[model samples]
Target: YAKTSRTELLHFTVGGKDAGWMDKRAFTATLDKATYSKMSRGAKIGDAAVSSKHGLYTKPNNTAEDGEKIGLGSLYANQNVQIIQSAKLSTGVT
Candidate 1:
């Protein structure tokens, strides 16, 4: 896994299609029917949570982005938010 951030777009290797944005962080696109079957509970995308029983990227986090408002929150913490400002990504995590 690339350990993609919630906002990073996922590209499919088998379908040649951009799986789409990680809406609320995607553990998996649950691509093919077979792929969906392979996952179990406890999987997650970003700050979003996965399905209760079916962990294979079943449910989406459903957290919407706060548009033009003042609040107590971080940008990168949201799905699909750019990390260019929050942290640096190099060849390694450490």
Candidate 2:
């Protein structure tokens, strides 16, 4: 069986001040030998695939009235924000 897992940690700053860090983890289901072999045979160097699910939201602040924001407290005065991401692939098969 083949299983894949990945983790991403990011540190961010705003206006030269430390904002916070975002940590994310992703996992893929284990593949049996036959499925893994088929996938491996079809894939080639430099080939790529992507899978993702994400959202952007405005965090509420103390000034916000009821039902004004999506999640918990606001971000330094109600700034709408989303995470920016990049990906790199590494292979261990030889």
Question: Which candidate ranks first by TM-score, i.e. highest?
Answer: 2
Question: Between which residue pairs do clashes occur in model 2?
Answer: 60-74
What is the C-alpha local distance difference test score of each model?
Answer: 0.31, 0.31
Instruction: Tell how far residue 50 is off in model 1, in angstroms.
Output: 42
Itemize residue pairs with steric clashes in candidate 1: 7-80, 40-55, 41-55
Model 2, 1-94: lDDT tens digits are 2223654655667899997765523323232221122121222222122111212124212222222344322222233334233222223221
Instruction: Rate residue 36 of model 1 by lDDT.
Output: 19
**Which residue runs of candidate 1 sit more than 4 Å off their true CA positions?**
1-14, 28-94
- Estimate the TM-score for candidate 2: 0.19
Q: What's the residue-level lDDT of 36 in candidate 2?
A: 21
lDDT of 2 at 70: 46
Model 2 ranges off by over 4 Å? 1-6, 24-94
Which window of ten consecutive residues has the lowest lDDT sum in model 1?
Answer: 85-94
- Tell me the lDDT of candidate 1: 0.31
